[model samples]
Target: MKYDALQRLLVEHLNSRPVPPHAAARLARVRAAALARHAQRQRQRVRLPEALGRWLTAHNAAARRSAWAMAMVTALSVGYLGWAEWRTPSEADVDIALLTSDLPVEAYLHPNFTRDL
Candidate 1:
């Protein structure tokens, strides 16, 4: 059997069947060695650039600040617009006399009401 298959079989057999003290110690040593090999391989695969990491950190902070400033400006503009609209008078505030002054309905109905030219 392959090393991985052998390791898996050993683990399964050890878990299923009760082993004596020496066999248990031997299995523990094998498991530790396998785990150390896996950890070393993982460490070798990770690569990071020093300059890129610093640049990304600075760029992220600046972006966050800019976003906050933009949001504040937008909120202030909307609030000012709402306040100005609320303070302005509506059509209901016009004087009633302006609407009633130009009527000729009563004069038109009476035949005797005439204008001499």
Candidate 2:
């Protein structure tokens, strides 16, 4: 109840007093100066060396991440291909199979053994 009464009194006191015209002009000048300072601060921020440093830091992080991803993909592809190759039989194994077969030795020596000349 006391707070409400105080608030009502403050409202009545504020409503009774009229602001002078000079105060509005002074407020306008202060607002313009504040806006000008804010603009100047923004301009100075762009001109500072730390702005370039921040840009370079962000750019380098993205580049590093991209390079690392590409390297990992390449490594995994090469590793998978190497593993597949290891699973398959080699040229030496094919030669041994051919040499140990029960077919005639002359048949193995012919270049077109399966086809008629």
Candidate 3:
């Protein structure tokens, strides 16, 4: 294959000429420095998840408190609505008030007359 021939040619060329000792040492030093940098980056990359977990652990109590507060607010709102519905007067109360009132029924029916008055 063409790739096999090219690989053989490259190998032959490299074998024919020896790299200088200084150049080989410099290449090794560069490789070691690159490997060190790569290892440090990998360590830093792996720490992200751990950092996030720590942050969540630190704020877990606050999150739980907020959830409890929301639940309390929801329960209070439902309780207040249930109480209001139960305490509301029916048509019987209206009839009794109309019969017992000194004012005319027409005054109760007037749009301008509020319950506050």
Candidate 4:
């Protein structure tokens, strides 16, 4: 493959090149910065609410897209909560409805119940 030949030439050139004295310090700084960024992102995730953080981490979010992703997560969570609130009856509602009445659950399961109604 063309990529295999290119990689071989690049490897030979790198092996034959002399290492610069300043390269170590530069590499160390770059490594430290990368590690610090990684740690900071971890801290940010920890500080976030657990569900949002889990969703983002599960998807392997990119560092540069985190801000937009966070906004999307929050909006989606809010919309979901709002929708769920409107779509389903709360426990209190069921309790209130049955507070003064009792019905046998088996009544609803009888095959002729609907036909008789």
Candidate 5:
């Protein structure tokens, strides 16, 4: 409500007043002064290159740490998979055992069957 009242007041004053030529010049000077003050404050605050360098250094360090962690995890996963593969028995292992051993296949297939003496 206060904003609306202020806006109405501004509109009424603008409508009632004749346009002054010096108003534009005064406004331009005000804008320039505000901008100059803002620029001066910014210059007094921090140097741009130093701020950017600090940010970039932090970002690069974080990136390198993430990459190192990812590489380590990937290496561990690959090593685990390789170890599991090496430890597991395969079909070739079974075939080799069957070929090298003298166990009868029928005894495995028919354990319950018996011959009458």
Candidate 6:
């Protein structure tokens, strides 16, 4: 090839849009190895939070089960409270109690009933 053609080929290759396959492969390997080494070093220098995170993930199922159990207990407690409120004695219950007792209904129903007691 002519010297001018060789110079043009060198310039074009240098300004190429895509990388050569071998260079790309080598760069990928270097980057991957660097990242792997960083991760390994980070693991060796483990912090409390990282260790705790690992522990939590390892017991993920147990954590989920405990959370579900707590939720069920809370739901049951709320439901029981609602049921108790609904079952509370009303004015009718007082009237029924009065009727069942030996005392006269009118005396118990009188305005002075509380004051008399």
Score every model by TM-score: 0.33, 0.33, 0.40, 0.38, 0.38, 0.36
Would you list the C-alpha lDDT of every candidate in the order shown?
0.78, 0.88, 0.91, 0.82, 0.85, 0.90
Which residue pairs clash in candidate 1?
A: none
Model 2 TM-score? 0.33
- Find the candidate with the highest lDDT and give its number: 3
Which digits, one per residue and each the tens of the lDDT, describe model 4 over residues 1-117?
Answer: 999999999999998978786997899999999999999987774545777777867775476388788899999999999999899998888667556446576765699977997
TM-score of 1: 0.33
Q: Please write out the lDDT profile of model 1 over residues 1-117, one tens digit for every residue.
A: 599999999899879967889988999999999999999987784446855676678788779789899999999999999999899776665335335657556744576655521
- Tens-place lDDT digits, model 2, residues 38-63: 99988764656887787778787778
Off by over 4 Å in 4: 46-117
**Local lDDT at 51 for model 3:** 82
Which residue pairs collide in model 4, if any? none
Model 5, span 1-117: residue lDDT tens: 999999999999989977687997898999999999999978785689988887778787778789899999999999999999999999999779777767686654575634521
- Give Cα distance to truth, residue 104, candidate 1, Å: 20
Pick by TM-score: 2 or 6, better one: 6
Clashing pairs in 6: none
lDDT score at residue 111, model 2, on the 0-100 scale: 87
- Per-residue alpha-carbon lDDT of candidate 6 for residues 1-117, written as tens digits (9 for 90 to 100): 699999999999988878889999999999999999999997797799988898888887978899899999999999999999899989898778877988887787698888988
Compare candidates 2 and 4 on lDDT and give the better one: 2
RMSD of each: 15.2, 10.9, 12.4, 11.4, 10.6, 12.9
**Best-to-worst ranking by lDDT:** 3, 6, 2, 5, 4, 1
> What lDDT tens digits, residue by residue, belong to model 3 across residues 11-58?
999999889999999999999999999999777755788888878788
Worst 10 residues of 6 by lDDT: 102-111
Which candidate's TM-score is highest? 3
TM-score of 3: 0.40
